[model samples]
Target: MKQLLLIIMLFLISVAAYAQKVYSVDYQNQADVKVFVVKYENQADLKVYKVKYENQAGDNNGKWFFTDYSNQAKKKIYFVDYENQADLKIYFVEYENQAGWSKMSKKQLMY
Candidate 1:
């Protein structure tokens, strides 16, 4: 019984250690957008991006950015450090199919 209990405890600990979480963020102070802080166990990197296609210069590409300076949702494609959770806003933009960075707009972001 002692060995069995030890095995069970080990299994639970391993499962808890390997779990990863996803967060949703918004610029509002209200509860409309589901936002949560990420606490990494160690040195790690988390990326957030929007996957979409739009006609621009006759090309296509996958799009992703860390965080832009402003939360206006209408601006260029830029990345800023992820600091304040309240300033985070989901921005969306259109880009050439599989091309690269293009014009970023507020409408391009989502949950």
Candidate 2:
């Protein structure tokens, strides 16, 4: 029974760890994180990949699953017009395997 309980707790922890559901808000004030899309990957703080399914979302490692509703998302983000105005700068990657944090110091912004 103790092993079963441990297994259940571990499963729940893993699920919570990977929940990177995000929503794009229209206004900067409505966002949890202000994002700027960098043209070059080298310029980005994080390399993001848009995952089609919510289950495929990464554990704050840049695999983002966009939710249809803001309430359903873990984080609400706004895209800034300029890099200087942003709290986090990201580059969209072409492949899932390429998605991850380039600068670890900026990682807490997503959380």
Candidate 3:
């Protein structure tokens, strides 16, 4: 009975861990995180690279695989009209090797 309970608990934990749902709000006030896309990698607080597969996505790392549907996304992001409205500013990098958070303080925004 204890083993069965432990297995069930583990399953619940795993499910919760994968429950990264992302929604893009039309307004900045409705968003949990504000984002900015920098024109250059050097100007970014976090350098991001889009992955081809969801399995390749990392924790608070710039490896993002955009889901075809919003429901399937782990992190919902809304692109604000202005830089000041964003909570987390990101720059898309050309190379996967360049993907990462330059400012560690903003790392929690992704997770």
Candidate 4:
């Protein structure tokens, strides 16, 4: 009976592990800066990552991602999805006067 319970627990754990969704930022093709809107499978938190990319070194660049429940200005990535191919891929750029983070539309994306 104990062995059967252990088997059931292991099965449940594996199922949970299989449920995660992940996306890759096309850094090579992104704007100078890219905002990646990552939605978690848990639905408990919504995140917008601000990424600053450069064409200089191969590995390091000035990428940044920030979010606050502060106000509605940061709602650009509120509805992004990884599974849907139509959804925006993660990347960053500079906004108009805002000067810090910018959301790139599907057309503006480098890739």
Q: Show how many residue pairs clash in every candidate, following the order shown.
A: 14, 0, 4, 10
Of 1 and 2, the candidate ranking higher by lDDT: 2
For residue 85, give model 4's deviation from the true position in Å: 15
Worst 10 residues of 3 by lDDT: 14-23
For candidate 3, the TM-score is 0.73
Model 3 Cα lDDT, one tens digit per residue, 33-67 = 78888777776788888777777675556777766
- What lDDT does the true structure give each of the candidates? 0.31, 0.91, 0.73, 0.31
- Please give, for residues 1-111, the per-residue lDDT of candidate 2 as tens digits: 999999999987775765689999999999999999999999999999999998888889899999999988889999999989999999999999999999999888877
Return the top candidate by TM-score.
2
For model 4, how does the per-residue alpha-carbon lDDT over 12-98 read when each residue is reduced to its tens digit? 765333221122333424323233343432321112223332111111121223223222111123222343433443333343222
TM-score winner between candidates 1 and 2: 2
Q: What is the Å distance of residue 19 in model 4 from its true position?
A: 2.5
Scored against the true structure, residue 40 in model 3 reaches a CA lDDT of 73
Candidate 2 Cα errors over 4 Å, as ranges: 1-18
Error of 2 at 11 (Å): 9.9
Ranking by lDDT: 2, 3, 1, 4
Distance (Å) between predicted and true CA of 2, model 2? 7.4
Assess candidate 4 and give its TM-score to the true structure: 0.23
What is the model-wide C-alpha lDDT for candidate 3? Answer: 0.73
TM-score-based ranking: 2, 3, 4, 1
Candidate 1 residues 1-111, lDDT tens each? 999999999987653332211122343332333322234312112123343221111111223322233342222332324534422233233332332223243122322
Deviation in Å, model 3, residue 108 alpha carbon = 0.8
